[model samples]
Target: MYRLFAGIEIPREIGEELQAISKKVTGASWRPIENYHITLRFMGEVDRNTAEDLDHELSLIEAKQMQLTLSGAGWFGSSEPTALWASVEADEDLTRLAERCDRAAKRVGLSLDKRKFRPHVTLAYCKGTPLQEAAAFAEKYGFLKLGPFWADRFHLYSSWSGKGPSRYVSEAEYPLT
Candidate 1:
Protein backbone atom coordinates (compact mmCIF):
# COMPACT_ATOMS: atom_id res chain seq x y z
CA MET A 1 0.00 0.00 0.00
CA TYR A 2 1.12 3.58 -0.68
CA ARG A 3 0.23 6.62 1.37
CA LEU A 4 -0.90 9.17 -1.16
CA PHE A 5 -2.21 12.72 -1.51
CA ALA A 6 -2.77 15.46 -4.09
CA GLY A 7 -1.28 18.92 -3.45
CA ILE A 8 0.15 22.09 -4.91
CA GLU A 9 3.88 22.53 -4.75
CA ILE A 10 5.45 25.62 -3.13
CA PRO A 11 8.27 27.54 -4.78
CA ARG A 12 11.74 27.42 -3.30
CA GLU A 13 11.60 31.10 -2.24
CA ILE A 14 8.34 30.59 -0.39
CA GLY A 15 9.69 27.50 1.31
CA GLU A 16 12.71 29.46 2.49
CA GLU A 17 10.47 32.18 3.90
CA LEU A 18 8.49 29.60 5.85
CA GLN A 19 11.71 28.08 7.13
CA ALA A 20 12.73 31.40 8.67
CA ILE A 21 9.81 31.54 11.10
CA SER A 22 9.84 27.87 12.06
CA LYS A 23 11.59 28.53 15.32
CA LYS A 24 10.41 29.19 18.96
CA VAL A 25 8.30 26.10 19.62
CA THR A 26 9.42 22.95 21.42
CA GLY A 27 8.09 19.46 20.69
CA ALA A 28 6.73 20.78 17.44
CA SER A 29 8.39 18.74 14.74
CA TRP A 30 9.02 21.41 12.09
CA ARG A 31 8.50 20.13 8.60
CA PRO A 32 11.39 20.33 6.17
CA ILE A 33 11.42 23.20 3.67
CA GLU A 34 10.99 20.73 0.80
CA ASN A 35 7.87 19.21 2.42
CA TYR A 36 5.82 22.39 2.25
CA HIS A 37 2.64 22.34 0.17
CA ILE A 38 -1.10 23.02 0.24
CA THR A 39 -2.61 19.55 0.33
CA LEU A 40 -5.63 19.18 -1.95
CA ARG A 41 -6.61 15.65 -0.92
CA PHE A 42 -5.30 13.16 1.56
CA MET A 43 -5.77 9.52 0.52
CA GLY A 44 -4.38 7.67 3.49
CA GLU A 45 -3.47 4.32 1.94
CA VAL A 46 -4.45 2.29 -1.10
CA ASP A 47 -3.37 -0.82 -2.95
CA ARG A 48 -1.61 -0.64 -6.33
CA ASN A 49 -4.73 -0.95 -8.48
CA THR A 50 -6.60 1.74 -6.56
CA ALA A 51 -3.55 3.98 -6.69
CA GLU A 52 -3.39 3.60 -10.45
CA ASP A 53 -7.09 4.33 -10.84
CA LEU A 54 -6.78 7.37 -8.58
CA ASP A 55 -3.82 8.61 -10.60
CA HIS A 56 -5.64 8.22 -13.88
CA GLU A 57 -8.71 9.99 -12.50
CA LEU A 58 -6.62 12.86 -11.14
CA SER A 59 -4.87 13.28 -14.46
CA LEU A 60 -8.22 13.97 -16.05
CA ILE A 61 -8.90 16.93 -13.74
CA GLU A 62 -9.34 20.30 -15.47
CA ALA A 63 -8.34 23.51 -13.68
CA LYS A 64 -6.71 26.81 -14.50
CA GLN A 65 -3.51 27.94 -12.89
CA MET A 66 -4.12 30.11 -9.83
CA GLN A 67 -2.24 32.50 -7.57
CA LEU A 68 -2.13 31.68 -3.86
CA THR A 69 -1.02 33.70 -0.87
CA LEU A 70 0.33 32.41 2.40
CA SER A 71 -1.36 34.76 4.77
CA GLY A 72 -1.54 34.65 8.58
CA ALA A 73 -0.82 31.66 10.81
CA GLY A 74 -2.86 29.27 12.91
CA TRP A 75 -2.94 25.94 14.66
CA PHE A 76 -5.21 22.95 14.87
CA GLY A 77 -6.20 21.02 18.06
CA SER A 78 -6.88 24.39 19.76
CA SER A 79 -5.88 23.98 23.38
CA GLU A 80 -3.80 20.92 22.61
CA PRO A 81 -2.39 22.61 19.45
CA THR A 82 -1.55 19.65 17.24
CA ALA A 83 -0.09 21.71 14.38
CA LEU A 84 1.09 25.09 13.17
CA TRP A 85 0.01 26.16 9.70
CA ALA A 86 0.50 29.01 7.29
CA SER A 87 -2.90 29.77 5.78
CA VAL A 88 -3.43 30.22 2.03
CA GLU A 89 -5.65 32.97 0.70
CA ALA A 90 -6.60 33.02 -2.94
CA ASP A 91 -9.41 33.32 -5.47
CA GLU A 92 -12.11 30.73 -6.09
CA ASP A 93 -9.66 29.21 -8.53
CA LEU A 94 -7.97 27.41 -5.64
CA THR A 95 -11.23 25.94 -4.38
CA ARG A 96 -12.27 24.94 -7.87
CA LEU A 97 -8.99 23.09 -8.33
CA ALA A 98 -9.55 21.33 -5.02
CA GLU A 99 -13.03 20.38 -6.10
CA ARG A 100 -11.61 18.81 -9.24
CA CYS A 101 -9.31 16.76 -7.04
CA ASP A 102 -12.32 15.76 -4.92
CA ARG A 103 -14.23 14.66 -7.95
CA ALA A 104 -11.24 12.66 -9.10
CA ALA A 105 -11.02 10.88 -5.75
CA LYS A 106 -14.70 10.04 -5.80
CA ARG A 107 -14.64 8.91 -9.43
CA VAL A 108 -11.98 6.39 -8.48
CA GLY A 109 -14.33 4.85 -5.85
CA LEU A 110 -12.67 6.53 -2.88
CA SER A 111 -14.81 8.09 -0.18
CA LEU A 112 -15.01 11.87 -0.60
CA ASP A 113 -13.45 13.87 2.23
CA LYS A 114 -16.12 15.23 4.52
CA ARG A 115 -14.08 18.22 5.73
CA LYS A 116 -14.56 21.45 3.88
CA PHE A 117 -11.60 22.54 1.76
CA ARG A 118 -9.38 24.88 3.79
CA PRO A 119 -6.11 25.58 2.03
CA HIS A 120 -3.04 25.91 4.21
CA VAL A 121 0.53 24.62 4.34
CA THR A 122 1.28 22.75 7.54
CA LEU A 123 4.44 24.25 9.03
CA ALA A 124 4.93 21.76 11.80
CA TYR A 125 3.40 18.77 13.56
CA CYS A 126 3.07 19.33 17.27
CA LYS A 127 3.65 16.64 19.87
CA GLY A 128 3.03 17.17 23.60
CA THR A 129 3.64 20.91 23.25
CA PRO A 130 1.84 22.95 25.86
CA LEU A 131 -0.93 25.27 24.77
CA GLN A 132 0.94 28.26 26.22
CA GLU A 133 4.01 27.60 24.12
CA ALA A 134 2.02 27.12 20.96
CA ALA A 135 -0.03 30.23 21.63
CA ALA A 136 3.04 32.32 22.24
CA PHE A 137 4.59 31.13 18.99
CA ALA A 138 1.48 32.09 17.10
CA GLU A 139 1.18 35.43 18.84
CA LYS A 140 4.75 36.34 17.97
CA TYR A 141 4.73 35.34 14.32
CA GLY A 142 1.15 34.89 13.26
CA PHE A 143 1.21 37.95 11.06
CA LEU A 144 3.28 36.14 8.43
CA LYS A 145 2.33 37.07 4.89
CA LEU A 146 4.07 35.51 1.93
CA GLY A 147 3.30 35.34 -1.73
CA PRO A 148 0.53 35.77 -4.10
CA PHE A 149 2.60 33.20 -6.00
CA TRP A 150 1.59 31.36 -9.10
CA ALA A 151 0.56 27.74 -8.70
CA ASP A 152 0.88 26.24 -12.13
CA ARG A 153 0.48 22.58 -11.24
CA PHE A 154 -0.50 20.00 -8.70
CA HIS A 155 0.87 16.50 -8.09
CA LEU A 156 0.11 12.95 -7.02
CA TYR A 157 2.47 12.58 -4.09
CA SER A 158 3.61 9.60 -2.01
CA SER A 159 4.12 10.30 1.72
CA TRP A 160 6.74 8.59 3.83
CA SER A 161 6.31 8.99 7.59
CA GLY A 162 9.18 8.02 9.81
CA LYS A 163 11.22 9.19 12.82
CA GLY A 164 12.92 12.11 11.05
CA PRO A 165 11.47 14.65 8.67
CA SER A 166 8.48 13.40 6.64
CA ARG A 167 9.18 12.58 3.00
CA TYR A 168 6.84 13.30 0.10
CA VAL A 169 7.74 12.25 -3.43
CA SER A 170 5.79 13.54 -6.39
CA GLU A 171 4.84 10.43 -8.35
CA ALA A 172 2.88 12.21 -11.06
CA GLU A 173 2.50 15.75 -12.31
CA TYR A 174 -0.76 17.31 -13.49
CA PRO A 175 -0.69 20.67 -15.19
CA LEU A 176 -3.30 23.40 -15.00
CA THR A 177 -3.46 25.38 -18.17
Candidate 2:
Protein backbone atom coordinates (compact mmCIF):
# COMPACT_ATOMS: atom_id res chain seq x y z
CA MET A 1 0.00 0.00 0.00
CA TYR A 2 1.13 3.56 -0.68
CA ARG A 3 0.10 6.74 1.12
CA LEU A 4 -0.98 9.38 -1.34
CA PHE A 5 -2.56 12.83 -1.81
CA ALA A 6 -3.08 15.54 -4.44
CA GLY A 7 -1.74 19.12 -4.04
CA ILE A 8 -0.65 22.29 -5.79
CA GLU A 9 3.05 23.13 -6.02
CA ILE A 10 4.01 26.58 -4.75
CA PRO A 11 6.42 28.72 -6.75
CA ARG A 12 10.06 29.16 -5.70
CA GLU A 13 9.81 32.85 -4.70
CA ILE A 14 6.78 32.26 -2.49
CA GLY A 15 8.48 29.26 -0.95
CA GLU A 16 11.51 31.36 -0.11
CA GLU A 17 9.39 34.06 1.50
CA LEU A 18 7.58 31.52 3.65
CA GLN A 19 10.91 29.93 4.57
CA ALA A 20 12.16 33.28 5.85
CA ILE A 21 9.06 33.84 7.97
CA SER A 22 9.30 30.28 9.32
CA LYS A 23 12.63 31.09 10.99
CA LYS A 24 10.98 33.71 13.21
CA VAL A 25 8.69 31.32 15.08
CA THR A 26 11.18 30.45 17.82
CA GLY A 27 10.35 26.90 18.86
CA ALA A 28 8.00 25.62 16.18
CA SER A 29 9.06 22.79 13.88
CA TRP A 30 9.12 24.18 10.33
CA ARG A 31 8.09 22.17 7.30
CA PRO A 32 10.72 21.83 4.58
CA ILE A 33 10.31 23.87 1.40
CA GLU A 34 9.87 20.80 -0.77
CA ASN A 35 6.85 19.75 1.29
CA TYR A 36 5.12 23.11 1.02
CA HIS A 37 1.79 22.64 -0.80
CA ILE A 38 -1.95 23.02 -0.35
CA THR A 39 -3.38 19.51 -0.26
CA LEU A 40 -6.60 19.11 -2.30
CA ARG A 41 -7.36 15.59 -1.11
CA PHE A 42 -5.73 13.06 1.15
CA MET A 43 -6.09 9.54 -0.29
CA GLY A 44 -4.74 7.31 2.42
CA GLU A 45 -3.18 3.91 1.72
CA VAL A 46 -4.23 1.94 -1.37
CA ASP A 47 -3.04 -0.87 -3.60
CA ARG A 48 -1.22 -0.38 -6.92
CA ASN A 49 -4.31 -0.87 -9.06
CA THR A 50 -6.36 1.68 -7.15
CA ALA A 51 -3.52 4.16 -7.27
CA GLU A 52 -3.12 3.78 -11.00
CA ASP A 53 -6.84 4.20 -11.57
CA LEU A 54 -6.90 7.34 -9.43
CA ASP A 55 -3.99 8.77 -11.39
CA HIS A 56 -5.70 8.11 -14.70
CA GLU A 57 -8.93 9.73 -13.54
CA LEU A 58 -7.06 12.76 -12.20
CA SER A 59 -5.35 13.23 -15.58
CA LEU A 60 -8.69 13.74 -17.27
CA ILE A 61 -9.51 16.85 -15.22
CA GLU A 62 -9.09 20.14 -17.07
CA ALA A 63 -8.80 23.14 -14.77
CA LYS A 64 -8.23 26.61 -16.10
CA GLN A 65 -5.22 28.46 -14.72
CA MET A 66 -5.89 30.68 -11.73
CA GLN A 67 -4.04 33.26 -9.67
CA LEU A 68 -3.32 32.75 -5.96
CA THR A 69 -2.09 35.05 -3.22
CA LEU A 70 -0.80 34.08 0.21
CA SER A 71 -2.33 36.58 2.58
CA GLY A 72 -2.06 35.83 6.32
CA ALA A 73 -0.45 33.60 8.92
CA GLY A 74 -2.51 31.38 11.21
CA TRP A 75 -2.35 28.34 13.51
CA PHE A 76 -4.64 25.31 13.34
CA GLY A 77 -4.99 24.27 16.98
CA SER A 78 -6.41 26.39 19.77
CA SER A 79 -4.41 25.47 22.90
CA GLU A 80 -1.80 22.82 22.30
CA PRO A 81 -1.00 23.60 18.67
CA THR A 82 -0.99 21.17 15.78
CA ALA A 83 -0.05 23.34 12.78
CA LEU A 84 1.05 26.78 11.60
CA TRP A 85 -0.10 27.91 8.17
CA ALA A 86 -0.23 30.76 5.68
CA SER A 87 -3.79 31.58 4.79
CA VAL A 88 -4.68 32.01 1.13
CA GLU A 89 -6.74 34.96 0.05
CA ALA A 90 -9.95 33.84 -1.61
CA ASP A 91 -9.97 33.47 -5.38
CA GLU A 92 -12.95 32.09 -7.24
CA ASP A 93 -10.81 30.43 -9.89
CA LEU A 94 -8.80 28.61 -7.25
CA THR A 95 -11.98 27.42 -5.55
CA ARG A 96 -13.43 26.10 -8.80
CA LEU A 97 -10.20 24.26 -9.59
CA ALA A 98 -10.12 22.71 -6.11
CA GLU A 99 -13.70 21.57 -6.49
CA ARG A 100 -12.89 20.09 -9.88
CA CYS A 101 -10.09 18.07 -8.31
CA ASP A 102 -12.36 16.98 -5.47
CA ARG A 103 -15.01 15.80 -7.90
CA ALA A 104 -12.43 13.96 -10.01
CA ALA A 105 -11.13 12.17 -6.92
CA LYS A 106 -14.67 11.12 -6.00
CA ARG A 107 -15.27 9.85 -9.54
CA VAL A 108 -12.30 7.54 -9.00
CA GLY A 109 -14.00 6.07 -5.86
CA LEU A 110 -11.99 7.92 -3.19
CA SER A 111 -13.84 9.27 -0.18
CA LEU A 112 -15.00 12.86 -0.58
CA ASP A 113 -13.72 15.47 1.87
CA LYS A 114 -16.71 16.56 3.93
CA ARG A 115 -15.18 19.74 5.22
CA LYS A 116 -15.53 22.91 3.17
CA PHE A 117 -12.27 23.63 1.37
CA ARG A 118 -10.15 26.45 2.75
CA PRO A 119 -6.94 27.14 0.89
CA HIS A 120 -3.76 27.42 2.98
CA VAL A 121 -0.19 26.17 2.89
CA THR A 122 0.99 24.70 6.19
CA LEU A 123 4.27 26.25 7.34
CA ALA A 124 4.96 24.24 10.47
CA TYR A 125 3.67 21.93 13.17
CA CYS A 126 4.06 23.06 16.74
CA LYS A 127 4.30 21.75 20.30
CA GLY A 128 5.33 22.82 23.86
CA THR A 129 5.23 26.54 23.05
CA PRO A 130 3.04 29.19 24.58
CA LEU A 131 0.05 29.80 22.34
CA GLN A 132 0.33 33.53 22.91
CA GLU A 133 3.74 33.66 21.26
CA ALA A 134 2.47 31.98 18.14
CA ALA A 135 -0.54 34.25 18.06
CA ALA A 136 1.61 37.32 18.47
CA PHE A 137 3.91 36.19 15.70
CA ALA A 138 0.97 35.63 13.42
CA GLU A 139 -0.42 39.06 14.21
CA LYS A 140 2.93 40.65 13.47
CA TYR A 141 3.64 38.97 10.16
CA GLY A 142 0.22 37.94 8.95
CA PHE A 143 -0.21 40.92 6.68
CA LEU A 144 3.00 40.33 4.79
CA LYS A 145 1.67 39.29 1.41
CA LEU A 146 3.79 36.89 -0.62
CA GLY A 147 2.65 38.54 -3.88
CA PRO A 148 0.77 36.43 -6.44
CA PHE A 149 1.39 33.57 -8.82
CA TRP A 150 -0.45 31.46 -11.36
CA ALA A 151 -1.90 28.15 -10.24
CA ASP A 152 -1.43 26.27 -13.49
CA ARG A 153 -0.93 22.71 -12.34
CA PHE A 154 -1.45 20.20 -9.56
CA HIS A 155 0.22 16.89 -8.73
CA LEU A 156 -0.42 13.42 -7.41
CA TYR A 157 2.02 12.71 -4.56
CA SER A 158 2.98 9.59 -2.60
CA SER A 159 4.34 9.33 0.93
CA TRP A 160 6.03 6.72 3.10
CA SER A 161 5.37 6.62 6.83
CA GLY A 162 8.33 6.21 9.16
CA LYS A 163 9.73 7.22 12.55
CA GLY A 164 10.34 10.88 11.70
CA PRO A 165 8.65 13.07 9.05
CA SER A 166 6.99 11.22 6.19
CA ARG A 167 8.89 11.22 2.90
CA TYR A 168 6.80 12.51 -0.01
CA VAL A 169 7.38 11.81 -3.71
CA SER A 170 5.50 13.22 -6.69
CA GLU A 171 3.92 10.49 -8.81
CA ALA A 172 2.51 12.64 -11.63
CA GLU A 173 1.79 16.24 -12.59
CA TYR A 174 -1.31 17.31 -14.49
CA PRO A 175 -1.29 20.73 -16.11
CA LEU A 176 -4.30 23.02 -16.30
CA THR A 177 -5.76 22.88 -19.79
Candidate 3:
Protein backbone atom coordinates (compact mmCIF):
# COMPACT_ATOMS: atom_id res chain seq x y z
CA MET A 1 0.00 0.00 0.00
CA TYR A 2 1.04 3.59 -0.61
CA ARG A 3 -0.02 6.82 1.07
CA LEU A 4 -0.57 9.60 -1.42
CA PHE A 5 -1.52 13.22 -2.12
CA ALA A 6 -1.41 15.80 -4.93
CA GLY A 7 0.33 19.14 -4.35
CA ILE A 8 1.99 22.14 -5.96
CA GLU A 9 5.73 22.40 -5.35
CA ILE A 10 7.22 25.34 -3.47
CA PRO A 11 10.22 27.10 -4.94
CA ARG A 12 13.51 27.19 -2.99
CA GLU A 13 13.40 30.87 -2.03
CA ILE A 14 9.83 30.69 -0.66
CA GLY A 15 10.66 27.54 1.26
CA GLU A 16 13.64 29.33 2.82
CA GLU A 17 11.41 32.20 3.90
CA LEU A 18 8.99 29.78 5.56
CA GLN A 19 11.88 27.99 7.27
CA ALA A 20 12.91 31.29 8.84
CA ILE A 21 9.50 31.77 10.47
CA SER A 22 9.79 28.52 12.46
CA LYS A 23 11.16 28.92 15.97
CA LYS A 24 10.88 27.91 19.62
CA VAL A 25 7.33 26.59 19.69
CA THR A 26 7.04 23.74 22.20
CA GLY A 27 5.42 20.47 21.07
CA ALA A 28 5.53 21.54 17.44
CA SER A 29 7.46 19.52 14.89
CA TRP A 30 8.61 21.96 12.23
CA ARG A 31 8.43 20.52 8.75
CA PRO A 32 11.63 20.55 6.74
CA ILE A 33 11.88 23.09 3.91
CA GLU A 34 11.98 20.40 1.24
CA ASN A 35 8.60 19.02 2.35
CA TYR A 36 6.79 22.33 1.99
CA HIS A 37 3.89 22.14 -0.55
CA ILE A 38 0.35 23.37 -1.09
CA THR A 39 -1.65 20.15 -0.89
CA LEU A 40 -4.64 19.76 -3.25
CA ARG A 41 -5.91 16.38 -2.20
CA PHE A 42 -4.94 13.85 0.46
CA MET A 43 -5.67 10.33 -0.81
CA GLY A 44 -4.62 8.20 2.11
CA GLU A 45 -3.49 4.56 1.83
CA VAL A 46 -4.16 2.58 -1.35
CA ASP A 47 -2.79 -0.53 -2.95
CA ARG A 48 -0.06 -0.23 -5.58
CA ASN A 49 -2.46 -0.95 -8.46
CA THR A 50 -4.94 1.66 -7.27
CA ALA A 51 -2.15 4.20 -6.88
CA GLU A 52 -1.16 3.61 -10.47
CA ASP A 53 -4.72 4.14 -11.63
CA LEU A 54 -4.96 7.41 -9.75
CA ASP A 55 -1.70 8.65 -11.20
CA HIS A 56 -2.76 7.91 -14.76
CA GLU A 57 -6.04 9.75 -14.28
CA LEU A 58 -4.37 12.77 -12.67
CA SER A 59 -1.98 13.15 -15.59
CA LEU A 60 -4.90 13.70 -17.95
CA ILE A 61 -6.24 16.70 -16.03
CA GLU A 62 -6.39 19.71 -18.41
CA ALA A 63 -6.48 23.01 -16.59
CA LYS A 64 -4.74 26.33 -16.98
CA GLN A 65 -1.75 27.15 -14.83
CA MET A 66 -2.60 28.79 -11.52
CA GLN A 67 -1.35 32.05 -10.04
CA LEU A 68 -0.73 31.56 -6.31
CA THR A 69 0.09 34.04 -3.58
CA LEU A 70 0.97 33.10 -0.03
CA SER A 71 -0.38 35.56 2.53
CA GLY A 72 -1.09 35.38 6.30
CA ALA A 73 -0.34 32.67 8.88
CA GLY A 74 -2.62 30.65 11.10
CA TRP A 75 -2.97 27.49 13.17
CA PHE A 76 -5.55 24.72 13.05
CA GLY A 77 -7.17 23.39 16.27
CA SER A 78 -8.18 26.02 18.78
CA SER A 79 -7.62 24.94 22.41
CA GLU A 80 -4.76 22.53 21.74
CA PRO A 81 -3.23 23.46 18.41
CA THR A 82 -2.39 20.66 16.02
CA ALA A 83 -0.75 22.60 13.16
CA LEU A 84 0.70 25.94 12.11
CA TRP A 85 0.29 26.90 8.44
CA ALA A 86 0.86 29.73 6.00
CA SER A 87 -2.41 30.49 4.22
CA VAL A 88 -3.14 30.87 0.51
CA GLU A 89 -6.23 32.79 -0.45
CA ALA A 90 -8.73 30.91 -2.62
CA ASP A 91 -8.78 31.88 -6.28
CA GLU A 92 -10.79 30.54 -9.20
CA ASP A 93 -7.82 28.86 -10.85
CA LEU A 94 -6.70 27.18 -7.62
CA THR A 95 -10.22 26.07 -6.74
CA ARG A 96 -10.70 24.56 -10.19
CA LEU A 97 -7.40 22.74 -9.96
CA ALA A 98 -8.35 21.21 -6.61
CA GLU A 99 -11.76 20.20 -7.92
CA ARG A 100 -10.22 18.49 -10.93
CA CYS A 101 -7.88 16.56 -8.66
CA ASP A 102 -10.83 15.54 -6.53
CA ARG A 103 -12.73 14.32 -9.57
CA ALA A 104 -9.74 12.30 -10.74
CA ALA A 105 -9.39 10.62 -7.35
CA LYS A 106 -13.08 9.81 -7.10
CA ARG A 107 -13.10 8.34 -10.61
CA VAL A 108 -10.34 6.01 -9.44
CA GLY A 109 -12.63 4.75 -6.63
CA LEU A 110 -11.07 6.71 -3.76
CA SER A 111 -13.50 7.97 -1.13
CA LEU A 112 -14.44 11.64 -1.26
CA ASP A 113 -12.85 14.06 1.20
CA LYS A 114 -15.70 15.56 3.23
CA ARG A 115 -13.92 18.72 4.27
CA LYS A 116 -13.92 21.83 2.12
CA PHE A 117 -10.65 22.57 0.34
CA ARG A 118 -8.56 25.10 2.27
CA PRO A 119 -5.13 25.65 0.75
CA HIS A 120 -2.12 26.17 3.02
CA VAL A 121 1.50 25.11 3.34
CA THR A 122 1.85 23.49 6.72
CA LEU A 123 4.82 24.84 8.71
CA ALA A 124 4.59 22.46 11.66
CA TYR A 125 2.48 19.88 13.42
CA CYS A 126 1.87 20.57 17.09
CA LYS A 127 1.50 17.76 19.57
CA GLY A 128 0.01 18.62 22.97
CA THR A 129 0.96 22.28 22.52
CA PRO A 130 -0.57 24.97 24.69
CA LEU A 131 -3.27 27.20 23.17
CA GLN A 132 -1.71 30.48 24.28
CA GLU A 133 1.61 29.61 22.69
CA ALA A 134 -0.04 28.70 19.39
CA ALA A 135 -2.06 31.92 19.39
CA ALA A 136 1.01 34.02 20.06
CA PHE A 137 2.93 32.32 17.27
CA ALA A 138 0.14 33.07 14.77
CA GLU A 139 0.04 36.70 15.75
CA LYS A 140 3.80 37.11 15.47
CA TYR A 141 3.98 36.12 11.80
CA GLY A 142 0.43 36.70 10.57
CA PHE A 143 1.47 38.91 7.69
CA LEU A 144 3.59 36.48 5.67
CA LYS A 145 3.59 37.47 1.96
CA LEU A 146 5.62 35.14 -0.19
CA GLY A 147 4.35 34.80 -3.70
CA PRO A 148 2.68 35.53 -6.95
CA PHE A 149 4.17 32.30 -8.28
CA TRP A 150 2.94 30.43 -11.31
CA ALA A 151 2.09 26.77 -10.79
CA ASP A 152 2.28 25.07 -14.16
CA ARG A 153 2.26 21.59 -12.65
CA PHE A 154 1.39 19.51 -9.63
CA HIS A 155 2.70 16.14 -8.45
CA LEU A 156 1.46 12.89 -7.03
CA TYR A 157 3.51 12.18 -3.89
CA SER A 158 4.11 9.15 -1.68
CA SER A 159 4.94 9.32 2.03
CA TRP A 160 5.30 7.12 5.10
CA SER A 161 4.27 7.88 8.66
CA GLY A 162 6.75 7.39 11.49
CA LYS A 163 9.33 9.13 13.66
CA GLY A 164 11.81 11.65 12.29
CA PRO A 165 11.08 14.18 9.50
CA SER A 166 8.36 13.25 7.01
CA ARG A 167 9.65 13.14 3.47
CA TYR A 168 7.40 13.07 0.39
CA VAL A 169 8.65 11.55 -2.84
CA SER A 170 7.05 12.58 -6.10
CA GLU A 171 5.63 9.60 -7.94
CA ALA A 172 4.37 11.48 -11.00
CA GLU A 173 4.15 14.98 -12.43
CA TYR A 174 1.05 16.41 -14.14
CA PRO A 175 1.40 19.58 -16.15
CA LEU A 176 -1.38 22.17 -16.31
CA THR A 177 -1.68 23.82 -19.74
What order do candidates take by TM-score, descending? 3, 1, 2
lDDT of 3 by residue, 133-176 (tens): 88888898887788888899999999876789878999999988
Candidate structures ordered by lDDT, highest first: 3, 1, 2
Query: How close is each model in CA RMSD to the real structure?
Result: 1.1, 1.7, 1.0
Taking the candidates one at a time, how many backbone clashes does each contain? 0, 0, 0
Q: Residue 137 in candidate 3 has what lDDT?
A: 87
**Candidate 3: clashing pairs of residues:** none
- Please list the residue runs of candidate 2 whose C-alpha ends up more than 4 Å from where it truly belongs after superposition: 24-27
In terms of lDDT, the best-performing candidate is 3
Number of the top-ranking candidate, with TM-score as the measure: 3
- CA lDDT of every candidate: 0.90, 0.83, 0.92
* lDDT for model 1: 0.90
Of 1 and 2, the candidate ahead on lDDT is 1
lDDT-wise, the better of 2 and 3 is: 3
- RMSD value for candidate 2: 1.7
List candidate 1 segments past 4 Å from native: none
**Candidate 1 structure quality by residue, lDDT tens digits, 54-129:** 9999988888988888988888886698999898985699898888888888888889799989999999999998
> Residue 134 error for model 3, in Å?
1.0
Q: Supply candidate 1's per-residue lDDT for 9.
A: 91
Residue 65 Cα positional deviation in candidate 2, in Å, after optimal superposition = 0.9
